[model samples]
Target: MTYPSYRNYVREPVIKVAGTGPARSGTEVWAELDRAGRSRSDRPLIVVDCYPGVDLSDLRKVAERHLPDYQVIDVEDAAALPVAEIDAKIADNLTDDRVFGVLGRQTVDDFYDPDALRQVRDQVAGRTTPVVLVGWGALLVGADGGQPAGTGDAVVVLADMPRWEIQQRQRRGAPNWRCDNGAEDNLRKIKRGYFVEWRAADRHKKHRLFDAMDYLLDTTRLAEEAVLITRDSFQAGLTAAAAGPFRLVPFFDPGVWGGNWMSEVIGLPPSDTNYAWCFDGVPEEESLLLDVAGTIVEIPAIDLVLQRPVELLGERTYARFGAEFPIRFDFLDTMDGGNLSLQVHPLTDYIQETFGIPYTQDESYYLLDAEPDAKVYLGVRDDVEPADMMAALRRAEAGAEPFDAEKYINVFDVAKHDHVLIPAGTVHCSGRNSMVLEISATPYIFTFKMWDWGRLGLDGRPRPVHLDHAERNIQWDRRTDWVTQNLVDQVQRTGAGDGWVEERTGLHELEFIEVRRTWFTGPVEHDTAGTVLVLNLVEGAEAVIESPTGAFEPYLVHYAETFIVPASVGRFTVRPSEAAVGQELATLKAYVRGTERAPVGRPVHDTKEPGLS
Candidate 1:
């Protein structure tokens, strides 16, 4: 886990305030404008830009009602004109004295024309009237499609919406150009627009708008909230000394093996099918919540790592993984659902060679809840032949005989609190009627599914299978005997104190992660040891985590909630809330290991109670 000390990676300082709250109502828009000192005679032009799937017709109606004097212009109305011509029209009209303000609406697609955007930026610069240009692409592509220096003056507000909301909007036939055509075409356009184009645009580039944002409006909740961004708030976030503990807005997605566990437990409306995965702590795809004053601002989590790597990830981890979070925690729900596809992940070297990533995903499944018949398909049976396994999979793919998966894969009966190690190149799946917390490396989406049961995906198509890739990476040596000896954690009592006991559960050669479970009736002291730690209150109703030094506020974490302990915090304590102190509390802790030592916070033998030995 130790790496060579090198400070080669340094990100330029960029500060922006991104906030999330309920979708804004018309009245809220008027309130925000009034707060910004805007009036009817201000001749303000508000440009409401949105993501492809978002409908802004209602927003425009509200603006018109509030500012009856301003002329409202829908950019979609000019869709027939070439992008350059539209830019020309905007430039010509920018200087009109009679016009109170212009309201421009467009999607991220329009911003792809860099020259047109630059022209619009130039027009807005010369005009004394306040212009509010809104669009999802504005923050991402900026004015010149490079940096956002030209957008420094305008009041930039990012309408923060969760991906789930966007999907829901799409399903409801939101007013998009593609939606008018047909559902099939609309779905295809959405997939290509968000997944393919937007992802590529955000992969490596820093969105300059984030650093220049004046205010962030969260539209993800029922009541919209706006937070003003400042450099001090941004700095506090990196150090884990922010006003409060931050949790990214979780997003759920359906899969072929989706289940209703999340819907039932989290009180989500029942989906058409089931919800399979929840992106709880995937920093690449998650956003951080920053409470500025009383308002909550949402920003992409990666910005914290890039801006203050040492503060967020610690010096050692930042040096080793750079800006990467290195660890991820996501949910795999199979409760009242089907089993996951049988799959393997590539080894570190193989992933680097093929996908150009620094690390591979070596994950472990920690069963949070399970039915009596819950099982996990792991490793390969001792007597199974590799060639025969391949033959069976191919036959299943060909629609001949179904693959007798259990004959080759080891199906282990699982129960709650069971931790199953699934390192790279290990075949595995979470069986039906179980909820698993997948703790692993951050490089997701590299799964090589070897076989899936004879079932179609939510889209009614066969899921892609990567037999060739899986075959090359599958460690045949990690059969039944090896899996039993190493993959399954050997629980050992590591520490005990008054009303508390800690047990080391995981930490094997297959991965750098180490996990421990603590059961306590009172508070437990812990140390970060210059490495970030991810903790989940698996069994407790609620707990408060506080730094002994009083550098940060007491952070409350609810049951099944995940939070991080920054390396800078050094030492902290986890205590159950007053109502739950009399009852036992159980928590699972995981962190990367760099040296040989006892579990963190282990009491010294001399400090142990009289009867503890």
Candidate 2:
């Protein structure tokens, strides 16, 4: 069984509060401290530990305003020594009693010896004076890897910021004294420190810090909002944490064939060029929002899957996929843009052997909007030779000649609402002038580009191509006839209700995912049936999703917004919103097949359906 990343595991914290960013005014900090009954003149020593590049000058000023006689100590000023010497210093400091009620600032870095941290925890125990430890890795040391530090009433707060903002600040020449390497290297170092080295430390300790957190300060947006985390709130279900329908924080990146649709529609800040992809619902890289007492707190989406695997994905799905959310929803904006690179994803065993991931990407494109004459490059010509095709791609890569993509690849005209299956090993790319909502398996970032249209990327460099990898995985038989017959979905009416109709549009042998479209003017009832369902309002203004027994909170969704219906929520209803009461609604829903599941394979012209057993 594949284990999930550390972020997946979560437990109810003693107390938790979330706010936007770490940057705050001294007055704000003073007010918060005052409210928490920590404003006494003889307040315990506040340890202010901070992540690299986080400025805490304002916080210090706030503390001093409340306690005029308080002293502030920067731990970095202490002499660095061997573990033995550090242990001695810690012992001496603990018994001194002279520094009681003094605030100490600790900078926990990758180089800090873990043993020294344990010593600090031991020294601080049984102290009458309060202590605050602040820093990115402060919890790792302060809590002794999540054990109670035995410092009475000690409150731990996390001042959090997004990785992108940190990188952006670094690019602007912000001081990152911890690294001697240049900006790019420093960025990689920070990522590795968090996602790799730090995560590999004591697992129990890692889990404890988050469980012990009293507050989380998020400085990702302007006007920082603080969220209070209480056990009552966490266990109260999704309604309490999410408040209502929520969207993950989306991220955009430019590509070789980047498009302008996202740049124009999303109003993203000016970048090198148009943005090409929007990670809308790829939970592994996306963050969800928890609105606690009116403050929005961001947490990795995987946390929900881990916290409620059976509830969110149903028992069967949880058993099959573990904590991994099997479905991925993202946007490919090729509108008013160039064609994507000719690419193919690895088959199941190949991805497992090459990348160690359990599943390969089995993707499909649901054209949301497409300009007249827009096309999709799919499969290869029936008469084309594999050797000749590889030779042409190589020639194009070398700039020897422009590759005529349509000469070997079959190009199909695309229209709005067309659903096309792009199982692994099928050669495919979105042609210019189309907005595609790509739904697929969760394994992303494994595309092997067989060819690019001989163009430079946004960085003004020739994009890399992976011909050998593509050749190994590509299904040579999925040519023109196979593409036209099997890759295209067949729409069939499945069910209907008063003023409503449902149709199954996609279900093939290549993958076990199923897609259905629903058109309704009134209410429509559905069941999760021990599987999670992802639905997108493709053709309506808005809708309200409610659990009949009030088992789940009512969710309000807008057009193009993607939402999940947890398996625990078994049966639910979707009705047009008040504004849309008289109008028709068209929604596209996707889920893994409950039975007759097929192993990942290449798309082929097969007429027989796979057996359930």
Model 1 Cα displacement at 25 (Å)? 6.3
lDDT per residue, candidate 2, 398-441, as tens digits? 87998889899999998888988898999998999888889999
Q: After superposition, how far is residue 219 of candidate 1 from its true place, in Å?
A: 4.0
Which portions of model 2 miss their true places by more than 4 Å? 1-112, 122-130, 142-153, 159-182, 185-206, 221-245, 252-256, 260-272, 595-613
The candidate that achieves the highest lDDT relative to the unseen native structure? 1
Candidate 1, lDDT over the whole model = 0.63
Q: What's the CA error at residue 139 for candidate 2, in Å?
A: 3.0
After TM-score superposition, the amount by which residue 581's alpha carbon in candidate 1 deviates from its true location, in angstroms, is 3.2
TM-score of 1: 0.75
